[model samples]
Target: MSLLVDTANRDTLHTLLLKLTADTKPLWGKMTPQQMIEHLIENVQYTNGTLIPICRRSPEEALEAKQRGLNPDVQIPKNLFLGDLPAEYAYLNLPASVTRLMADLELFDRYFKTNAMAIHGGFGPMDYNEWIIWHSKHFTHHFRQFGLIEGDI
Candidate 1:
C-alpha cells in the first residue's frame, strides 16, 4: 500500500504511531523507542527545511537516487545511521519523543503544501510528491523495525 504523507493519510499515519509505547522493542536494529522517535523527527525536520545537511549529491547522482526511490522493489536501506541525536533529545522519554514527533509531522504536513521542494540527505532534491513517497517509505521502514507493521521485515 502506498502511504503518502498527504491530508488523506496523515490521520492514518498518526494513528499508526499511536500504537507505539515506551516499552516497545525492535524486531531488528538497535534503536530504542525514544531514539527511533527522535530519528523520525529529525528526518521530518529535514523535509520541513529546518535541518540542512553539509553534504549533498550531484545532479546526476540525485537523478539516479530519485529513479531508485521510484522503484517499488527497492527496499529502504537498512541500519542507515543519519547522525547523532541532539542534546535536548538525548534523554527524552518515549512518550515525550512521540509527542514531539507527532507535532513535527503535523508541521511538516502543513509546510509541504506550499514548499517547492526538499533536499534529502542522500536522495538530494525532491518535489512534494517525491518527499511524500520518501517519508512514507521512511516511516514504514521504522515501523517495520519495531514490528509495528507485520510482514514488512
Candidate 2:
C-alpha cells in the first residue's frame, strides 16, 4: 500500500524509522542520519503550516508540481539541495532526532485533517490531501536513501 500518514500506515512508517541508527549510511546523497531526521521534521512543519518555505511558486509552477506529485511513476528529483541544516538541529544526536521525528509524525497525523494550506518550497501551495501524498512521497524518498525500503525508489 502507499504510505499515507493515517492509522494503517503510521506503525509501518514508525517501524521503518526505528530501524535507523547513528551509523546508518545513505546509499546516495550526503545527509547524516540525524540531519535526515531533522530535515524530515522541518518538512513536516512546513506541511502543517508552522514553517514557511524559502520560496513560493507561480500558478504555472504550482500546477506542474501538483501534476508531478500525482504521477505515481515519477521519482523524487535527486540531490535537491535544501540549504544548511537549521542551527537548532545541528547538534542533535541520532536517538534524539529519531524520537523527535516520530513525535513530529504523530503531530502531523493529528494536524493533517484540519484542511490547512502550506507552501511547499518546491511544490508551492498544497492543501491537506495533497500534503499527505507529498509527505508520503517525500518520506519514502528519504527512507530509500538509507536502504530502509528495498526494491523501491
Strongest candidate by TM-score: 1
Per residue, candidate 2 scores C-alpha lDDT tens digits across 27-144 of 9888878888888888887665566675467879878978887566787766777676555554358778777777766776676667576677766777767776777777878888
Q: What are the candidates' C-alpha RMSDs?
A: 2.8, 2.9
lDDT of 1 by residue, 1-153 (tens): 454333237677777777888788888677877778888888888877578753277888878988897665677767777666455555357777777777776777677778787787767777777876777777778887887776543
Clashing pairs in 1: none
Cα-based lDDT for every prediction: 0.72, 0.73
Candidate 2 TM-score versus the reference: 0.82
Candidate 1, position 127, lDDT: 75
